[model samples]
Target: MELSLLFEISMLLTSACAVLLAGWLLWQGQRQRAMPALAGFAAMMALWCAGHIAIVQQWPVLGIALVLANPLMPMFFLHFAVQFVADGSKPLPAWLQRGKLLPVLYGVTGSIILLSWLGGGGKVISSSGFSAFFVFQGIGWLNLLYTVLLGIAAHLILWQGWRIHSGNKRRSIVAMFLAGGWGLLLATSFVFPSLGLNWYPYPMLLLPSYLLLLVYGVVRYQVLAINAFANKALLWLGMLLLVLALMALVSALLGQLGMQALSAVPASQLWLYSALLLLLSAACYQPLSQLARRLIYPGGQLDESLLAHWRAELQQAQSWQELALRAGNLLSARLRREVSVQLPAAGDTATGLHILCRRDSSGWQYQLTGWDDVTPGYRLQGEVFAALLLSSCRILEQSLKLADAERKRLDQQHLVELGALSAAMAHELRNPLNIIAMAAATTPAETRGHIQQQLKRADRLIADLLSYSGQLQLQCSRLPLKPLLQTILSQQDWQGVQCQLKVPDGLTLYADSYRVQQVLINLTDNALAFCRNQAQAQICIETQHDNGDILLYVHNNGPAIMPQQHNSLFQPFVSKRAGGSGLGLAIVRRIMQAHGGDVCHRTDLGWPVSFELKFKQQPSALSTQIQDNIND
Candidate 1:
């Protein structure tokens, strides 16, 4: 093919690739305003490439129009780079921010160039005539001047972006620089010929490679979205293209060899030679394609090795801390930096050399430091390592949660066994105690009274144990709160202390009636005891509805519990009263919990000392039946 035709074909291919890349970028949702500018840049470059092809093909009018519009491409690139580097919150430099002037200039110059060409004032006299001082020369010099100026400005903006950006963003900017620089180098073919130098446009054939690099940046670094698989797809596509190209090359070589052999042999043997060449080409295609793929895509093996090693290390990690340490060591070796890993402090910053990876679900924060030597590729490695560290941390956390759950289950089983044994022993001792109490009744009244009191204490202890063990079956039903409170108050001795009931009428509770009664009796007894030493002793039982639940409060005009003792007060064997078995409140708490409610001491309430019981208000079949019976 003629060199000019080859250049045209190359330019056409580059234009198509550029347009496709521009379309893909613009179609993405996460591409901010900078991405649209980038898309515009790509589209304008494609148009410029098409203009070159048109010029080479002798379409002067169409070529001039496209060439006149070429300045817009670099301007668009500069605009994009400026925006890409700028932090949104900060204003850009006044000159850099004013992008409207470039388009205005392009419009004015483009019109001038078109008018000059139409007026027969501009014509190419020699290859160097574009820059030569010819009186009737077109606006070629002006176009060249503007192109150079815009290209310089675009590079400067890119450099600024590279300086300002960090981490993966800086890497993307570097990729853009390399790609754009390579395209500009190839573009020098036009410059050399314009300067009247003898040069082939073969360099321009590599223009499509520039677009590929930009596409690689978009995919590999995830300029749009952080997708690791996009890079994998790009790598696979590259490998496939390499294989196809090698197959074509092999076929071309075989065809050349067959033509030479046929030229040396007789015409009758031409068909035989062609068939043998065809077979040979086919035989070589796969092996050549495989060889090319191996040479061109050798990084796949290295990546796989790295991934496997990291995955194994991650699996062996015992905790988040261990994962961080191991990951830091791996990163240090890979990146050639002194790396330290630790949990992030409250005020730790993630700027500069620090890379912070946080997993809120696991409450883990990995701070990777000493990244001063980090390059773009090393930054990517750090990101992958951080991800691996996070995965390991999540696995470790889940394992710990499972282990803790298992431990709790085993402890509960042991508690059940111990409770069953205690209950059996208590039942066996109860009969003997009853007989002893009866026998003691034949003695003096005081001794008999003491023996009966001791027996009652033992019985209460056994009942408390049963409640804690969850052995007491609940018969939950709806009951009027007012009636229950009144019955309990009527049965209590009061001991000169005033008792008040503020339970609302018609208010109902769904709970085991017997267990609820037992809970209330325990609260009232404790309240009465605490209030006994008060100047104006009083106790109050009240109920209120809150958040789809019933809240019952037993209040006493007594000293408040100390803040330090609040948590342990509900635990078994913990009490503030003298000679108290300390099981009353514990049993009350356990019974309330078994009813799907909870008991808690409330110092912040209507009285100084109070205990609140919260119960869910959902109606059950038994509750509904009891309500109907009450109504009837």
Candidate 2:
């Protein structure tokens, strides 16, 4: 009698818990894709428990309802496992799709069993010791077979998912696998006593074990996304309620067992003891709840210390590029993904932490490539950490900006001193060269030619120094692109060289004509020097419009510049070719920069050596001319 009463109490408690969990899981549907199936399975489990309670109360209809719903519980569990492992953006597994008719077949089998029992083809044997037993007469064993098969199938799917996934996702599936497999194994044991076995079927006592595992999965791995119910007060209240339920359960079981200590207490005095116990539990709630939270979220407060460390490390960054690299590396280590930081001018490619620095006035964006792989714990605290990280980046940007300003100021001062020295050298060297040229003219013809060539080289070097050291003053006008190219090419002596002009006759560029001419001359000279020995040497000048800017490409069939020299190609006083003025490309770059343009070496399909000039579209009187050219 005691065991029967104890069984009844356990059924009531587990049923109530299942219902509550089902409701909560269903409410979490907004965040979890698997919630509906898990919630439905929980509801079915609650109904199964209620069926036992109804049978004890002599309610046969509800008992039959449990038989009808038995096959569905396992199906729901299998569905939950499939959706749990399946990605929302991807299709379901092929096996699942192929077995779509299995659920319908199971439903039909269950309905046939229900009909057989209702049509007097089955018998229900009730025991008088307050325990209910189920017996299927004709086709009822088929229902048991279906239930066992479905349960096995569900567990197989879970095992497959466990083997397939890794990391936190796999851990969550392990919880489900253990819980579902254990629950099915125990719950299946309930039918043994009806099969002419002398088993007591005490597995009901261990029925809640699976439910506890499910709770672990939900809490630890974010399987159900219960973050909404994770508030401190709510968590404490839940703990308190759990303790109260456990106390009630233990007291009821003890009373059923007829324990001497509890049997001696009066019914009236028990209320006072219960009230005192509640008061004591209330008092201890704070510390217990704190411990629970600490266990659940050990890394919740870790970001504060990490943020401090990041701030210190980021403070030591010397430039914007260095700061961005350091910040990207820090975030990548913390989030465990590939992260890249790009300036606003570099273009956005991925979705991630965008730090808008009002201090630097240039928005710095960080892209985290695999954001979906971030663990839930860090994702929950992402906003706070991102804000702190952004603040750190902004502070670094400010410091780097100040440092750059000082550096630029010093560079400008150095350039002023260098410019003064260059001017004085050019003036002194020109007078001595003039005297030498006159002296060499009186020598033999061969000596005179060599001296003149040396003097010309010196003069060209002086001219290059002056061009590099001097500031540019632009007198911008709309110059016809084709006519300008023709004039520049006509001035150059390309001996038996093919020079193709691809500029449109109507295309006009808004730039300083003199500066543009100098830029073209320097590019042509650079090209000719590289390809002077190659037979059938060719140079091609082409113009195209791109995003409101004009792109001028000069291509030459010359040996490609070595990769080692690319960086210092436009740097003054760096040259590899003999009898070459190294400042030619440097002066060209300066002239282009003064016109709000840029020059860069590019590798095209056929051209081994190519230089591209990018001219910004000016919003001046040339707009009409530019628009006409675009239309043409």
Candidate 3:
């Protein structure tokens, strides 16, 4: 079989494959129409291969075919180049968009060739050497101009793409292929057949391998996204075009050797040979991207492992403290480094979710210095994860606030319980105290009267406790202090006591008269009790006005109080005498507070103990019944 026949058959098959693939790509566009330029480029490839097949076949109408595809080749080269490099995305200016003109230039060149072929060949070059293919022919030079402009445009766009693109090294592969192909393409326009050179005019087709690469990018990476299995299609097309071109060369050589016709060779043999080479080329383009990724990242590990445990601890982690601990443990296990995670102060949610996880000597302010979940690296934790941690901090803050509020509530409940217990205790003990007072009042003036008087002192202490605890049913009213004191003094029991009253006659104070009388009686009893052994045993009760209110004092000539133990003596459970319930002075203080007044201890001229009362202003007349009851 002649090699030229084999080559011709291969080119024919490759072109047919390209046409089929182009159809498939066009069909695919109906669904994903985002890649029109890719579809146009596909059609261009198919047409190009078809034109090459016709050229090798020497079809009678071959010149007509060239008219269709010659200029189309350059125009499509420029158009698809523009589309493919920019991924069909850049908008062309109005002047540049009438790109169909580029194709017409090739078509007209082919027409001139066709016209000469009809006129019986070789006239395509005039004897005067002025033929269109050899010289400008008024318009042939336009093709050269077109070629130069398009070439420059291609260079500029390619430079632009190359500048911004940081992709695989395929651009160099593509550039080499384009430069070689176009170099031959330009030289052929002037030198082919006209110069009588025996070399093939269409040897430029051999370089479609470069265009095949663009098909690979589109399929493998969706570079053009016309949706064809472009790598496979371009592989088949390139193998066909190369085999056909080589076969043409071989056929000419074999024909010169006087070889027999190779139409006898079965077409299947050529198809199989082309098929094997196509499959091989297709297999080779698969990238090592997956393998590269694994080598770079290694063992599915993240960079965050470099941060040690202690760094995690110093971060402001609230509820996520637990998460920080788990992260530390995992990091420690993986990196074989101790992970110390530090959190901000306990009970403070203000510093929440800020992590200070650290690796030994590799921490930034005790923070992890390497990549975290999505952050890529530190000095920048993932904003999303950080936000999640902050939300957890907020929750912790709310929980702390709730806990504090509950604690305060519990404390208030305890205070309420204490107050209730005091009220109940006062009521329980007041009955016994009132009974003692009753006995003391009834005790005979003849039989052990001194012992009965001592028993009276105990009663006074109990009475005070009852009033202060709210157990006493106080009968509040306007009462005259001077009249009440006079009534208590007028009674026979106090006649021997020898206390003088200097209170002005109608001095009034607002109070429960009975409670007021109880307070005065207790004060006088205390004074008399201390007045013993004095050269003159006497008590002085007096009233005066001060600061918009009436003030009263009960003074005694008695043993002076030491400078120490002043205000504290009025505290509950405190007393000068042993076995006192320590409530008398405390009661006086509380009653005064409730009445908007106060009671205090001071001293008279002799440094004898004295008690003072300041009362709210009121009418001077106390009720007659309270006066009568006191005097009785």
Candidate 4:
């Protein structure tokens, strides 16, 4: 009668646990990534009951069911470990993958365990000390190895959980698995055998539920999303569960002692006993850690603190290096995760990437104790900081663009005013230039030598005036630089003084060719006239095109402009010679400007007087001007 009653009570407790497990696992199947695995755990429990019925009826079919059930323990755990720490990836890899081997190994191991069970190596013993009963397994030391393997697998699952990235919600799930697996393994190994060997059954059957959250992570969003990690909901749930479990343990102890005293009470009073325990468990939760504070902090002292910090971030110069460091700090501190961002080489083509973090490699920043970068050997877990990472990238780009735009706007305004002043000054000087030309024309044959000198000077002045007033706009048609230089020199008969124009072939400039040629002509003319001493004077014009700037240098072994006047070279009416309108180089500078080019004095006094004119280049540097007319 005692043995049968014990079996009957054990069956009731197992049945109740099976029902709860089934309901929870089934509900969770729809939510998490490893629902199929959790359901497998539920089926294992439900089928476990059938093994007893099959044994009672002497049915042979229960043999298969019993054998298959053992593997479910590992299968569920392996699946949860994958899900809990986000190790599992879809389209699971073949033979090489940890995922593929898990289920496959379960099948092989289950067969071995089953063969052992049926071969008389294992027996189930029923125990009854109080109103509750449980079946204890007596197996050889080999069976003890089974417990050891389970313990090891549980440790792995727990380790995987704890290693999850810092900013992810999956960490909570991992923490739960860690706690439960530890509890289950310790209970079976030490707790059950102590104090007259009371086997209350696996108390931490909710590991599968946490795995459900991982499944949810896959469908809705990653489990380790920053927002999910920051959320305190699951943490509260875990605390509540811990409190309830402790209350039940305490209540069961006190209730059992009371039952010993009150022998008149029915054994079925265990239902009322369990109920009271659950209620007390619900009440024994950790103190609510300031619900009002969490809500009001955004608008209160915390808000003030955050605003001050955000303002400081704004004040920091938006250099890529500074922004990167700031982002790294936030990711490290807020998520409690370590991360490193690497920049691609100047020529790399990749747009984006997300790599897993691990422990064996130098994966993350130094602050994290165990975590490292991902590799085949190391697995990554925790939260995915994808959104935050992407956000930082965009913010950096925007800040750079804003700074560049502000600088360009200020520069453009100055250029526009300078252009206006040039136009006004050209208008003011035109009439005076014509009067000087008339005076020089009228001085004529009466004083021929002086008249000729004055006439020649007046002619040069008129050319400068015209060049200044041109206000040339860049035509911007693509043309070769060599042909343009040749054409400008061709207009000048450099007979007495030989000229050598050396320019890279196929170099093109995007500018008004007319204005660019006009500047070159004025520069070459000035260079040739200054070659005073030598009978065979030499003038060489060299062109260098780089970084979209065309640098044309007109050189002559002539007197150089004074160092003090270099800044004033392009200004109107500034000259190195007397009776000079001081406008030849000035006119060249203005024409270069109209073509979006600039002319600068290349070197210091008495050195080869070189005038450099620069212009922006077009798409291709290919020379395509028809008919090479520089045969002269």
Lowest-lDDT window of 10 residues in candidate 1?
Answer: 623-632
Q: Please give the clash total of every predicted structure, in order.
A: 1, 0, 25, 12
Work out the TM-score per prediction.
0.42, 0.49, 0.31, 0.34
What lDDT tens digits, residue by residue, belong to model 3 across residues 1-632? 45344445544554555565556556654444434544555565566455444544554255224323334444544554554444444444455457675466457546644544354432233322222222233333444455456545655655555554544423542553455455556446334544455444344334444344444444444434433455555566677778766666665576567664763344455545666776675666455554564565444333444333323442444444564565445444544444443443322222322345222453222443233432222223333233334444445556767877888677446545655776677677767766765676666766547756565655554445544454334456767777788788675354345677787766667777876776776677667666754666788888888977878888887777667778577777776755566676766766565455789888744547788888876434333233211101
| Candidate achieving higher TM-score, 3 or 4 | 4
Q: Candidate 2's residue-wise lDDT over 1-632, tens digit each?
A: 26666667767767877898888787756477777888878888888788777766678776766755666787777778777777434344686767565577556656755665566433456543445665555556666677777777777776777767777777887777667667767776577656766566688767765675675574456643454444543565566566666656666777679796985565334544664676687779779987776676555445457768877877777665676667667866866755655543334434464333223446644333344555655554455545555666667667767877888777557656767888999999999999999899789999999999999999999988887776556777778889989998998879777889998879888887887999999899878777777899999999989998999999999888899989998888887677888898888887777666789988755789899999987756332322111101
Error of 3 at 614 (Å): 68
User: lDDT of each prediction vs. the true structure?
Assistant: 0.69, 0.71, 0.53, 0.52
Compute the lDDT of residue 122 as modeled in candidate 3: 24
Error of 3 at 86 (Å): 5.6
Clashing residue pairs for model 1: 122-138
Give the winner by lDDT: 1 or 4: 1
TM-score ranking from best to worst? 2, 1, 4, 3
Q: In candidate 3, which residue ranges exceed 4 Å CA deviation?
A: 1-3, 27-34, 55-58, 83-148, 164-191, 201-208, 217-219, 223-632
User: Can you give the lDDT of residue 410 in candidate 1?
Assistant: 79
Any runs in candidate 2 off by more than 4 Å, and if so which? Answer: 1-298, 303-306, 319-376, 619-632
